[model samples]
Target: MAGSELTNIKSPRVKAARRLAKRAFRDRDRSFLAEGPQAVREALALEGVVAELFTTAEAELRHADILFAATHAGVPVFRVSGEVMSELAQTVTPQGLLAVCRFLHVPLEQAVTAGSRLVAVLAHVRDPGNAGTVLRSADAAGADSVVFTDASVDPYNGKCVRASAGSLFHLPVTVGTPAAQAVARLKESGLRVLAADGAGERTLDDVDLSGPTAWIFGNEAWGLPPELLRLADEVVKVPIYGRAESLNLATAAAVCLYASARSQRAGSESGPAPRLP
Candidate 1:
């Protein structure tokens, strides 16, 4: 078609972005779906590559600027109906906008320590939502990085990505089961591995969390893996007097990571803090 004819050509509905939302297709195509205005915006803002953009009519809701950016970036944008958007969307509620993006390969060694040299590890967490929520909190709590270890749920899952809001784009993330030797390596390198336990006698308030610490949270059902716990230098549990059973994995992670951040901020204000030999 000529340029003039192409201008008049119909925009598409239900394009490649919709198809890539499926798990199999995401793997086969090496692309994942990012939904909502914020998710799409972050994917666009990433210094990495965005494969394509699919904005349903309902999802786009006639947002012209978004269309302009998508076109300018050379990302293909298609229009899908409300029904089609729901069909392709992973969420129960379709936010009306979605994008297909290539996953950035995050390295474990490089992303380990951030502010206060504090880190959070998700050991053997299986739920995608919980994993994502933890990542979001880690980023919000000023953590330098997060490591999802063992058989944790795929952090790339749509729900997880969505749960993070836009934090996933900005934070450094590492996923893998590093050898036990590697865990020991981090300990020797100066990470105070503080595992959160329900039975831990030490209160979070008792421990000086201002040093380079790696706050490890265990599985939702079982808590931390024994090997990791055994390697930890300290263990602290949330003090709960209410009749509640236990904190959710993500909730526990937020509490621990923020506590570390809180302690460090206090220490910095008071002057140099002492470290354990």
Candidate 2:
């Protein structure tokens, strides 16, 4: 809306935005693409996060407030044709809006502090969608932070970013930290680490999650390895009441995180635990 339309996908600006689709380019540029109105809005809400915005004529008209906010914040805006939007957007159907935003990951040490009540650690989780869904769930459950270990998928992956549904901007995120190191630092911060595994000895119902807690979620296909499982204070399994096989990684994470959140909140209201007889 601020300048002439970008019709050519090969233009310098368009090319730069397209390059962000790859992890290498994103890392080198310290930016990634946020598609759809929700992602763009969330990115613009953060100071100095949105560098540039791209929108079709229809999108600009429909989301005038967003464009106005971007212009007010000194971010450049370009109107592009639907064809051009397709090239910039990853989805099968273009959302007609996209934004180039800075990376938002913090260091593990910064994310997990002394007062962290709930945290989610993604260990060797390869699927970007799953990782993003887990992050969204963590945010909903009032987690203090979300950590993507070195073996996990990139949090900036377009699929992951979109799957987060703008929750990526809601809480602290740590990327590329080794799982073991993350667990060690969380433990050092006084968090009781729990690993979510289907074959774990302890069930979620058995754990007292009133205190500070960090959950370690493993890969989808294969659960946490023995070494990683050993790092946790306890390995927990969500009890299966029905005939279902097992819950997916994202679903399991949501259940585990909410369990801790509910327990902690209830514990806070009920005073200290009664002494065991």
Candidate 3:
């Protein structure tokens, strides 16, 4: 890492790995791309989660500290060309560095709700940007978990990953079949399921989010599925004064989640939180 000479990375192994990364094969192979010097640096902080690092001359010079940290962590570091870096990067601009890291699947059982859990359940949310924004808000509001179910966009998808601004690596997020089961299990485990519905009569203010609650935000066009609606202990709406018709799904989610955060914080300031139903 302290060497003055530039490292050349033109090995067949790097090529094959970059090729595999283009397909879902890398993901299927239990790895993902953490591109950009900033992203690579953020991901490297995860240590064991980040298995390897790739860089070009620009990254080595511009992001030397990042490269140094990855090398120091004993992660496999390879030097490649800017062209190859572009090939491996999901985005248009290559930040000169990328990382191949093992994907740590968050089991439904381990998803932040071990106890005193406040979670967000995003159901069939189609927009990766919306989904990612929900994650950013959840991170900011200190929610225990953010779960997506029913063919929602992959949170690990490049757009979602970037939209999360690296928060995807910050929290417990579960995707896949276990997600559906996770919802039912949370309900049975005394976690209140509150679905966000503009049509619903109950306002978010009416619900006490101070306790264990899973705030469910559905897709933009279709909204919550009938079954999920039936599963909710209650459906809450964010009060709208303007004639704007409706808020974006992610905005609504931030409103709902932060409302809960605000209520929880206020409750903490006062006496004990009232028993939430």
Candidate 4:
């Protein structure tokens, strides 16, 4: 494996890595930044994503296992100065690690039918952190894939990636898909699309989630509009048992996804989907 200790923050290589912080640059280059030891390690573990890795001298010493893994995988690992690492990292207190990774998203058509029994679709979500958390939750709940509608934040955004921790690289994610098209694809794949909202007449418990299902979570502020909600087979709400007005996007998503996962699993273990007469 090739390696070099770089100190110059103005180096062309350093500048190129920093450019990934911008959405336009990321889109143009078809790459993004994965920062910190955990994210970098995950990026290296996945095949054909970690193009190059940058680490500080201190990090090189502290995270020797990660460095060795990258080297074993034939990834180019560079030892950079603390300043250079900071410049590449989005966090204020850098973890002395960062990596240049190719885009991990797939097309909406490919993603919706990637043999996913349950999928989470975000419609017009704007917050990067919220989007990331939802992705992580979907992964945690054993969701097959996550899709971000065209109006949503970039799933590859630095903040979203950071919030996902290492889950970003764990599952299939689709971005820049329109809400209507995404819903149509999921439904065509035999998934019952359910829109999550606060005013739905049906609670999540009323739904039979054992069948293949796609759950659509709306934006942070406005939630799903009437038109988007109408695309779903049904509108469901998470029961608010407490004084809280409503659950946020991430929390609602987790609850909804987990319900489907558990129901599907139970149905599989006990009996198959019922057949019509």
Candidate 5:
């Protein structure tokens, strides 16, 4: 532990960390709270990302290795009471461990480069959980970057960060860029921009996914608008064979990104597989 247990909920340090629960305060400080052991571990893996760590005595003992790592890295660790932990945490159930981490988003140009093969763009997506799930899916699908457009939810939102399950620190993320500008940059980098919408001329199975691709997913309630759809090289949808109404934003994004990943890997070893009619 770096200092004595922080028992005072109204202490200056405790209050500053608690303020990160709000988006405005997070933006002002360029910092956000990463709750739970998993989120804390992930944030610590990256240099300088974790500024401070808060843990209860039980959590420190339960997750001794994590505390050791934080101390080894010179990250200040504060032992707080369970009550103080609750005050600093955003979740209904505090994990007894939390980390104050700096924002990790990079510039749009840096995120999508010439050699980039796979990318996910969230346009006008509002739900933090949905956006985080999409980001985690993109990371699993070997995407080079995930872009949260200007109108999309902040990637650093606590719920979104938790939903990402530590994948947020695994890949480059571009935030606050306009959807059109992001699409243009991806195209300029030679990526085929595909907009995923329920109503589209082509289905996922019909598109050629072997090449470098960028998938643009829209808001959960209403999908991509006409102007956003027009920006894509192709507008595609996930075909529903069963009687389900439709896939949610996160599910749809995973399907699209994985399809491209599979195709690209296959193309490298053998060749692009025949598209189903």
Candidate 6:
């Protein structure tokens, strides 16, 4: 299977890969596709993360290193055609490589307790790109984990996975948790839950983010509901000094998470307890 080209788009394996484009199929199979060399390479780096690897003939020659790594990891490497790769990939420009990966999400309790310093809870974020960007930002900020509430976009969606830029595999993530339940669990674990919204009474700069915290982000259009905001310990807003209307959800998340990260780092180095937010 490594050297042979799978040209037929209707091949059973090809069809199965294509079915991953649907949420129902991904849920049923508990598998998702990681396309492109970067995503595939990251998947292969983890033990048993990649179920299989698909490479086009031309791509196999160009990206032989990736294929070799996959094979070395004992993953089944199959050669596919350009047309077949395009059919299986979701991007406008196919990367000629793809991987079937097992579900990466962890249980809510497990993720909540993964490390407890900083967590990002997305309550009702509907956009897959935004959700993925937030996850990537969380990873960059050294957050402990990311929890996606039931109303949030599927983090395993192709667009979301691509937007994560391989961060999806780098952190502990819990999906399908209810917003209220997520907040309660984080609080029970002694983390301060700060709801990020435009109508918040307290500004982000006014809050002490050095303590363990869970930052909750809401939907793009409507933002967090009043009821949801009330569930949090406090509602915090990112101050806007410029003429720009509002920062997008991902940008806001990056700013808030990094602020917390900086505070935590500074506190640890100085041997002083971080102020509670």
RMSD of each: 5.0, 2.5, 4.0, 3.7, 1.5, 3.0
TM-score of each: 0.83, 0.96, 0.87, 0.93, 0.96, 0.94
Which runs of model 6 end up more than 4 angstroms from their true locations? 268-277
lDDT of 1 at 238: 78
Q: Model 4 — which ten-residue stretch has the worst lDDT?
A: 268-277
Tens digits of per-residue lDDT, candidate 2, 1-277, equal 4567889999999999999999999999999999999999999999999989999999988988899999999999999999999999999988799999999899988999998999999999999999999999999999999999999999999999999999898899999999889999999999999999997876787778889999999999998999999889999999888999899999999999998889898875553334334
- Residue range 44-89, candidate 3, lDDT tens digits: 8885978777777777888878877887898877776676676667
TM-score of 4: 0.93
Give the better candidate number (2 or 3) by TM-score: 2
Ranked by lDDT, the better of candidates 2 and 3 is: 2
Evaluated at residue 99, the lDDT of candidate 5 is 96
User: Could you tell me the TM-score of candidate 3?
Assistant: 0.87
Residue 252 in model 6: shift from native, Å? 0.7
Candidate 6 RMSD computed on C-alpha atoms after optimal superposition onto the true structure: 3.0
Residue lDDT tens for model 4, 1-277: 3366788989999999898899999999999999898898888888999989888888888999988988888888888888788777899998988899999898887788836699999888899999999999999989889999898999889999999998899988998998999989999999999999986887887768888899999988778999998989999999888999899888899999998988997874544334335
The count of residue-pair clashes in candidate 2 stands at 0
Which regions of candidate 2 are displaced past 4 Å? 268-277
Write down the lDDT of every candidate, Cα atoms only: 0.72, 0.92, 0.74, 0.88, 0.92, 0.89
Better of 1 and 3 by TM-score: 3
How badly does each model clash, as a count of residue pairs? 7, 0, 1, 0, 0, 0
Say which candidate scores most in TM-score.
Answer: 5
| Full-model lDDT, candidate 4 | 0.88
Tens digits of per-residue lDDT, candidate 6, 40-140, equal 98888888889988888878888888888888889998888888988999998998999999998988788887359999998899999999999999999
| 1-277 per-residue lDDT for model 1 (tens digits) | 0011111122333455556656667667777888888888887887555776656654455666767777778776766556666766788887767787887647665765333377777777888889889989989888877777756776778878888887777777766656354366457667878889886877676677877788877788988767767777877887675998888878888988888888877774543234335
Stretches of candidate 3 above 4 Å error? 1-23, 112-114, 268-277
